[model samples]
Target: MTGKIYIIGLGPGPAGWLTPEASAALEKVTDLIGYFTYVDRIPPRDGLTIHGSDNRVELDRSRHALQLACEGKIVGVVSGGDPGVFAMAAAVLEALEHGPQEWRALDIEVLPGISAMQAAAARLGAPLGGDFCAISLSDNLKPWSLIERRLQAASDGDFVLALYNPASKARPKQIFDAFALLRKLRPAQTPVAFARAVGRPDERIVLTTLGEADPGVADMSTLVMIGATTTHLIERPEGRPFVLTPRSYEANR
Candidate 1:
């Protein structure tokens, strides 16, 4: 008699952006589980069990939440940004696949959300307008060597690079390593952008060239953008910020 589990996307923090479908699912859920900070985004509702945990225990917590759903409790496994983009959706699916027998039978639906990359790209005026790829600097799952390969591939291809999980306490050197790698393939004057605490009140956006940029300035919550060879900064008389990557070769030239 297990109830279906809903993997909900909380978007970037605003309740207004929560899709009606997601909101309805959240309202019906008897249990809400997510990274501690993300769980706080849901509006208060009665008869809901809130399960929060440290970032390290995401897989364990998600497994437990799915088990709760299998036990007949309506559950919501939440993620900040899009659940599909380097978020809980993939983790939860992996947990179910590799988990014990009971987990495989549970019904799971993954809902999308506004990812930080999309939000940041919007805020920065479309740096991701052309071919782009996203890579996470966190070595917790993927090895740094693999990250470097991907970064090199993307940089050499002149793809707009969106970086996530750029920095963490135990892996402070990762961003620096990536920065060094990119510097080798791309020009030292390549433009880069960073969005900190995006979609939240404390959010800040920075635009600068690679020569002036420092990876040490980033943290776990920051999203970094490194422009392709065709990317450039356009200055406005009003001092507005904009980064553009051309789609056509003529536009790029």
Candidate 2:
């Protein structure tokens, strides 16, 4: 008998952020597969088997999960944030599409959870309250030129930008280059937020303007939000300021 496969999103970091649906799915799976960090988050049980691989081998991990499911083991391919957003769901689907015909007939479900961008937006005020777009700064799978074009288009269209994978040890310069480009396109005073390790123990949220924003504060874990021209901040007496992008654009017209 063919078993099932679930693409589960574990949310950003804290266990509380995990959705009820994803939790329930996790309980049913006989095996879990994912990147080492995310797979390590699951507690070991007697009947459940966990497979952890390197961060860059998403396709191989998906194939292994599919093979296990074909052998009648219920499998869970886990991801940190929402699996559909630059995570394992797409990888699993890609595997299914190219794998043997029997693999296609196996049961598969994608369980959604809170994404990093959403978590970051919540930690701040409502920076994504209006029109917005998310762009992954990592050019491992795609060209940097494409990313630049998308960034320019989003800026020109006045959409709030949620930038993922802003910087890493290997690709540190892209974020700075991106900042330079945004500086040319956007106003100096436009709000920019650096939300790092959000929802985790070491969470840090920094709010600044485009001209004053510091790119060095970001890493692989940070989600950088560049505000539209309409985005602004509200000062509070007690805590950090609130960042907001208005939903209506009547004033701009």
Candidate 3:
């Protein structure tokens, strides 16, 4: 009997957002492996072993998870947000393809969960309701030059942008550079949303314009969405305003 490995997405940092499928998979796994922060999200349970590793060792983590599964331990590899979106699913698949041949025989499944961009869009009332694209600002695996090119092209196309890993301790300037590049190409009043710790207790949102938005306000937990020119805000005197991109394309025609 070969134990299978499941790659589960925990949604955007909240228990409520976890999908029923992901929750069910978690219940069956004997071991949960992920980054330290993500592994911490799983509540302590009987008969479960938790393995946490540093942020940079995703391939190593995938290898270990596959190894455990081959040993007949049902293993769960967890990632916050959707594992497929700038997360662990691709890494696991890549590792499996290049790793020891035995891993190919093990059962591997990727369970979906809410991605940060989707959660952020929900809270912002659909800035990505139409054509949009997400780009990660981190250049860990890819080059910074490629990131800059994508940013410039996204700006040029006027596509709604959802930025992931916007700013961290080491890569702070990339966000600033992204903003500067976008500001030059986009209008001053173009709506930009900064959503932090979304779906969690400490969640906060700030809406500003391309010219006036400050990159200092964002950190690693933040998902920055730059709205299309067609996007607009609906003001509410007593609550958070609704921001949306209308579904109509009459303006473009």
lDDT string, candidate 1, 30-129, tens digits: 9988888988776676898898888878789778987897789988999988899998888888888888888888888888888888888888887888
Computed on alpha carbons, the lDDT of every model, listed in order, comes to: 0.85, 0.92, 0.90
**At residue 46, what lDDT does model 3 achieve?**
99
Off by over 4 Å in 3: none
* C-alpha lDDT (0 to 100) for residue 107 of candidate 2: 91
Superposition-based RMSD of candidate 1 using all C-alpha atoms, in angstroms: 1.3
Ranking by TM-score: 2, 3, 1
State residue 42's C-alpha deviation in candidate 1, in Å.
2.0
Candidate closest to the true structure, highest lDDT: 2
Error of 1 at 6 (Å): 0.9
Deviation (Å) of 17 in candidate 2: 1.0
| Residues 1-253 of candidate 3: C-alpha lDDT, one tens digit per residue | 4899999999998778999999999999999999999999889799999999999799999999999998999999999999999999998998999998988999999998999998988998878876888999998889988998998888777789999999899888989988988888888998999999899988999988888899989998999999888888889897777888877766743
TM-score of each: 0.96, 0.97, 0.96
CA lDDT for candidate 1:
0.85
Worst 10 residues of 3 by lDDT: 244-253
Q: What does the lDDT read for residue 207 in candidate 2?
A: 90
Q: Candidate 2 at 225: error in angstroms?
A: 0.6
